[model samples]
Structures are given as C-alpha cells and as structure tokens.
Target: MKQREFLKKEKEDIRILMKFAGIYCRENHSGEKVPFAFKLFDIKKIERKEIALCSECTRLLTYGLTMRLKCPHDPKPMCKKCETQCYHSAYKAKIREVMKFSGMYLIKHGRVDMLYHYFK
Candidate 1:
C-alpha cells in the first residue's frame, strides 16, 4: 500500500483506539473523565498518535503496535502509569516491521484468519 493510504488507516485506527481508551479511563479513574491531554497526542499537525495503554500491561491497546506500549523502568515501579511509560524506544519499529511482514505473508497465503487471530 502507498504511504498515504497506510497513514490514513493508521489515523483511523488511532481515533478508534483513543475513543476506547477514553471510555476505559473514565470508568476506572474515580468515574472522572480522562482529560483531553491523555486521549491523543499531536505528533504532527497532520498526524495524531493515541497514547492509550492498559494500566497493567502498559501495552498499546489502540494501535496494532506503537511507541506508546513500552516498558519504561522508572524509579516508581509502584505506580501503574509510570511502569507503562518506561521507554522501549524500539517498540514502534518492531511493531511496524511485524505488521509489514504479516502483510506480505497475507498477500502470499491469503489468510484473513492470521490477522484475526492476532487481534483476538
């Protein structure tokens, strides 16, 4: 796929993920809504990135695999949020590579189930 097409899909995925994250946060954080700052970050004027991660896993729950899901080794391992933010800067690259590999594999094997299984 062209870069533009991939970016469009990525943006849509980010939006959907942000919505889900917002809902989850509101339910968990004392029934208090998550602030806008927490929902999405503007990586660029045209591109946005969702910073959603499970409080426990710190895993990126929104995008297929993105920079946000890193295990940062912060001083306070006691804090769930801090634990999630530890920087594995390579996480995004790893995820992108895996996704690209899967795409190529799917083109050859044509199995939708592969994607479904991973998402599930």
Candidate 2:
C-alpha cells in the first residue's frame, strides 16, 4: 500500500482503539481520569482530541498503538485474521474484552455501523 493509504488506515485504527478505550474506561472503571496525550505517528490532530481514560486504559491504548505501528502486514489484516499475532497474550485478552464490551455497547445504543467491525 502507498504511504498515504497506510497513514489513513493507521489513523482509522487509532480512532477506533481510542473510542473503544474511552468507552470501556468510562463504563468499567472509576476514579479520576486524565486526558490522554497521543504522541506517536505525528498524528497532531488526534493529539488535540481530549480522550479521558484511567491509567490502565492509557497504558493499554499505548501498547495497542505501539503494536499496531509495528505490525509487519502491509495491508494489515484484522488482528483475529492475521497469521502473525503482534500482541502479547495478556494484552490481546484485554483488548478483546474492551472491543467486545464497547462493540456491544455501541450496538445497543444504536451504532449499527459498527456491526461490521464488531463481527468481522
């Protein structure tokens, strides 16, 4: 894929991950959360968005983004369909939990558009 395509996919993936993290953190965790600062991939636009997450969710999002950036697939396959697993087992499980919960929450709240990604 071209650099432009890769960056577009990267940005989309980042947005999805952040959305999932934000939803999970807000619903499942409590306490004072801070707005996360994203400093990777030169995504200044994303950095400006305020995504408040607990520390654990922040770490998970950071790890997820790092793993995503390091993925070797050119046209990156979905993690579940990828032959090469990039995430550590623990992180993978955590991410699955977040995705599952957030996906269902979105669907329940009328985000039918996410069904494809949720079921894929």
Candidate 3:
C-alpha cells in the first residue's frame, strides 16, 4: 500500500487498539485531537510535541500479533524518521523507553515470542 494509505490504516488501528487496551483521549491546549499514544511524559498538554511511531514501525505494530523475532534495526536499532521527529532531542531515550515498556508488557502478559525481537 502507499505510505499515506498505510498510515491512515495504522492510525485507525492505533485508535481502536488503544481503546481496546483502555486508553482515553484528550484535546491539547491548541485544541488539536490527541490520542493516548504516548506515555506520561509525552502528553500533548505537557510537551506540545506529538509523540508518534515511525510509519514503518507503526505498520509493524499495527500487526502486533504477527511480528517476527528480527530487529527492524538489524545491525543497530534505528528509529524511523517520524519517531525521530516526534522525540526531537530526547528521541534516543524515548524510543528505548518505548521498547522497554513494550517488551515488559508483552512478557508480563505472556507474549514471550514477541519479546524476542525487542531483545535484539
């Protein structure tokens, strides 16, 4: 699929999954729609920076049930451009935290096979 179409679907998927996983939404001070995609520190009200996944990774995550045990980064895990844009100066740490939380959550919830990719 084209990038725009892919992102549209992924965004919709994120909305639904986040809701299914029990997250709420709020409007930012500027009155823009913001989903609960970010953790506490990345909230729109607190930071103005909209946190998001790389389009590629978001696509991968949208199919959360089917990722393989291969690191998308391969030699070194690199952030997708969009994720880089979102975190700005703190991109590195934020991505790490996201990865860390994802791994732990999957493991805690008994998704052991999925955790393997994050380890790499």
Candidate 4:
C-alpha cells in the first residue's frame, strides 16, 4: 500500500481499537477523560474521538498508537498473525485482552466488516 493508504489504515484501526477499549473500560472500570490536550500527541490527524474512557485505557491507546506509528511493515498484517512482535510482553498481553474482548463485543454487535480483516 502507498504511504497515505497505510497511514489511513493505521488511523482507522486505532479508532476501532480505542472505541472497543472504551466500551470495555466503561463497563469494567471507573474514571474520567482528562480535558487537557497535549501538543505532542500524534493522533490529532485522526479526529480526537470523544468517547469516555478510564485513564488506564487512555494510556493503552497512547501506547497502541505509538506502536502503530512505529510499525515496520510496508503493508501491515494483522498484529495477531504477525511473525515479529514489537510490543513488550506486558503490553502484548494487555492489548490481546483488549482486542479479544472488543473482537467478541464487535461480533456480538454486528460489526463484521472490521472483523473480516482482523480475524481472517
């Protein structure tokens, strides 16, 4: 894929994961959305999604986006099926929990289009 396409895909994936993590966090935890926006956050290019998420989930999102931003793949494969894992073990486990939870939630809610690519 072209660089633009790759970037777009990365952004979309981030949005979906963030939304899913937000869903899980909202149901499983208690916290607030910090209103302060930082200048260094790279996710501005993607819309600032306004979902309410806990601080931990918020941190997970920052980590997740950072991982995506540094991805070495030209046309990235699904992270689950990738041969090389870039994330630290703790992060990998945490993200896997989030993804699995959100994947099932998405399937239950009929968001099959996203799953088609990820779970294929």
Query: Candidates' lDDT values, in order?
Result: 0.39, 0.81, 0.35, 0.70
Q: Over the stretch 2-113, how does candidate 1's per-residue lDDT look in tens digits?
A: 1222344345444443444443443343432322432333433333543333342134332422433232342224222454644345644544444555445555667655
Better model by TM-score, 2 or 4?
2
**Per-residue CA lDDT of candidate 4, range 4-111, in tens?**
433667767766766677777876777566532323454445658666666777777777767776789978887777888888888889988888887888889898
* Worst window of 10 by summed lDDT in candidate 4: 35-44
What TM-score goes with each of the models? Answer: 0.30, 0.85, 0.31, 0.76
lDDT tens string, model 3, 22-64? 2111111233432334421222332243434444333333343
Output the better candidate (1/3) by TM-score: 3
TM-score, structure 1 vs. true: 0.30
Model 4 residue pairs with clashes:
none
RMSD per model, one decimal:
13.3, 3.2, 12.5, 3.9
lDDT of 2 by residue, 1-120 (tens): 212233667777777888889899999999989988766555446544668999999999989988887788888887889999889999999999999899989989998685564354
**What local lDDT does model 2 show for residue 70?**
78
Model 2, C-alpha of 46: deviation from truth (Å): 3.9
